[model samples]
Target: MISKLRFNTVVGKKVLMAVTGLAMVVFLIGHLIGNLQLLWSGAQFNGYAHFLTAQPVVILIELGLLAIFLLHIVDAVVLLQGNYAARPVPYHTKKWGRSKSKRSKKTWASTMMMWTGIAILLFVPFHVWHFKYHNPVASARPDSGQVSPVVVGVGSTGVNTSGAASAPSKEAYDLALQVTKEFKNPFVSGIYILAMILLGLHMYHAISSALTSVGANHPRYQTLIIWGGRIFTVVIAGGFLLIPALILSGLIDPAKTLATAQAANNQVAQVPMGVGK
Candidate 1:
């Protein structure tokens, strides 16, 4: 049975699509958790970022995720094309089925899946460009060859110049601060919130659909599964929406939360060669 499965086959494509889509959902949950660290402190978020980037396997994981994303896109296009070819005549007046015996599982989210998916696809590149490649904070820092504080050691304490013990200063990339600055911009925050809404729509149907495709469609538990998907959609989407909303509302003040930068020369001079290790 496994040997007979191929990309040309419909079942094969659905299975691949289901697997890839589920993989992305897992990634989204993990990503949201990491991003939420921004609410705590810049030191905490930067520490989390440093831990991930410091791993040698991080590059490999990124490459794997890219492959999964591309595969999901290609499979979706093939399925869509096949669907159109199978039904050459578009429906003239589609209506939701209301009969109890034969109720339609269709939803607004399901109907607009392609549109939401496209919007998310466009947003992904812009997000990556804005946060990953562009760093206003780093760019503004002096050109001196000083190692930026990446991650602070957990529970570690260091003495200030006055020889008084203090919480180790986390003066690295300051991504948490940068995230605040970006979200405070009306244009950037607006785009982010809109993209999150579309993402919620896409996931609303996708979660149940992916589960069903993978054979989790037993009649006795189908309803339960669908409702669970709905709840998951709200939590993930709402969690993301709260970040920018809080920033814009002046609730998460970066000035009081982030670690202050020490003098440039002192920072560069104090950083050990084994930093971020």
Candidate 2:
């Protein structure tokens, strides 16, 4: 029926909002899996980052994601405004609980979805800048096949190591190094952790409402939907939360390790051509 749903109708807008939210949830899970590559090794993680960053498909996907996010936020704001305008002036806040048990109305997480959504929305840009666009150590050319099996440094910067390896491959920066440095700082890690907590809260309420908005709710399976919301929120939010926590705890010391990599590169550069042979 959505094929016939009109944008002017509340159900249509809600449906759009729900679909967008779920899309982002899938994106987050996929992203988390990719990010976990950092635990494997710098090359493994950086290569993955490089692969995604240089791809046209990834860029298009990112643009699509941006559109979805904007739609979701705008739709939500409009819906909230409509609900507000429809409520009787005196009953706007005081009587909203009349249809529900007092405890339901008092539930903070459900009521604070708007605030939590806003918080997560604001946090995303900071995250992008800190770990994506501004990455000091991610090789951008690996995905494009600019380099072969291994990229050697071009002078002081390059993603490969040929005759002279230098500066962690200038083209491809080491994301492991960048993120490790960022997360090691308490201010950065603290904000990250706090945002993840808020994200969990937002998802807890958002997912449940999203399920209902898309007509996935039926008395027979309502309990499953509720528990699914909780599982999704906890796994996604908790997974991301663990990353910064590990970095802050010094478990993911990519900065130091990167330096060691550079040191190794330098050492190899100085070796006599036939000495090892």
Candidate 3:
């Protein structure tokens, strides 16, 4: 029986789906926590973002995440194709609930899992483009004849006035600030918040279902899985929501915050020269 199942193509696809889905669930939790830093303040969020790209270990993790994302997408396409192939004939159904109640009784959230997955896939590239690729606000150019400012403690990846490295640019920072400023626009902010809510809904089902698909469905620990899903959903979604709320409230203004810090640094630089004279 075991060998027969192993040889089955459907079984192989199921295993692939389970593994990739679970990996993505873990990534989502980590990403949500990292994004939560935006709620504390602009400096805090920017520093956190900077730290992620600057660290070697984090860079490796990001590569792993990219791999997982690709694997999940590939598996999803394969599984979807297999599912369609298995049901090539269209059945005419007069009534929706005429079939087995066992299937109908399954949670609606779980049934809609594929739709949620599609939504997430659609959202990700837009998110990456907005925050990472072509980031306009974070780039900085050095003053004439001065080397670019070395992002202190940024090590080898740090930006310098010379602009030798594509280190986080002042342009990226300004872009980030401008993006946040848009949150003040009711329509834009509303859409962002709604997208986050959909993300939460997607995670809520995906987390526990992925576990169950991976042989964690035994009755002995099912309750724990359910509670874990709820908690994970709340924490991740709740934390992310705080960022938009704070931005809309004007509690975090990236441009103003950066300008203030730069002014203070300039004042400190001049103070020592005046004292010596």
Candidate 4:
């Protein structure tokens, strides 16, 4: 009987949502760590990007992530619909309801979960297209050596060991420079900051709720679990927010960084292919 209820019941759906949501939260932490590399040199960040793309399993990983993300979204929608059906009558007042016996766990974050999740859904594709598909280097300042020479066989795999300033070329698209340039735009920066805020709100409730759904309930550890989730929420959201904030404030200069990347690429271009090998 226990096995029969695993996937067919509302409890089963909540458990599935909890597991998938937690998986994504873990992915977010790893992604934040990788993005923090932007605080370093463009060459370093681009090298990291190059390494990721060069991996044979990258596509598989992406497909798997996509599957998990879609499943999470679908289940969330289903659960939300189920909730509406269960509560056909709307509440008269927007105030919180509580009794002497039990306190309500509802907060602003929990209340807005669906909306915030939808916003994040809209954000991910645009982000992927902006960084992954668009060639910002093509629109870069060519006169300032922001453009690097493209190698026919080799992509941006060339590491500029020279300490000179240069830009990433179409072949290797200086991703770090691209990031700085995009963030410098007021609209882009604003959108990213807003998105991170929504992510924080979503995560605040999600972590605690997910744990409860997964049967992690225990009076002894409840407070610790809730606080731990909040800390995780702040770190993930705050770390992402810092990037655009720094770029827009002129702390991470795009022009100088691009020139350095370009100079490195230019030097690498002049060297004979087999010389380094």
Off by over 4 Å in 4: 1-4, 98-102, 136-170, 254-277
lDDT of 1 by residue, 47-129 (tens): 67656655557568778988998999999899999988998888998656744435567889999999999999999888877
Task: lDDT for model 2, please.
Answer: 0.70
At residue 59, candidate 1 shows an lDDT of 66
Better of 1 and 4 by lDDT: 4
Question: Candidate 2: TM-score?
Answer: 0.78
Which parts of model 3 have CA positions greater than 4 angstroms off? 1-8, 94-105, 137-179, 249-277
Error of 4 at 158 (Å): 2.3
Give per-model TM-scores. 0.79, 0.78, 0.70, 0.80
Q: What lDDT would each prediction earn against the true structure?
A: 0.71, 0.70, 0.59, 0.72
Candidates, ranked, TM-score? 4, 1, 2, 3
Q: Please, what are the lDDT tens digits per residue for candidate 4 over residues 145-205?
A: 4332322212245443211343323244456765877899989999999999999999999
- Report the C-alpha lDDT of model 2 over 1-277, residue by residue, as the tens digit: 8677576798888999999999999999899898777766655666676556545687688899999989989998999999888964653445446367643423467889889989988999978876654442222333453332233232123444222333343333345655766788899999999999999998888787889989999889877887889898899999989888988997776445444546544444334332322
TM-score of 1: 0.79
Compared with the true structure, what per-residue lDDT tens digits does model 3 show for residues 1-277?
Answer: 6667662476666667778777766776777776665554445555666655445576577688788888878877887888789888888865446265644424655667678777777777876766554332222223333333322211222333334543433212322344566677777677667667777777777777777777777778887887788688778777777667767877765546554545433232223221311
On TM-score, who's better, 3 or 4? 4
> Which residue ranges in model 2 land beyond 4 Å of their true spot?
1-5, 92-106, 136-168, 255-259, 264-277
Per-candidate clashes come to 1, 16, 23, 11
In model 4, how many backbone clashes occur?
11
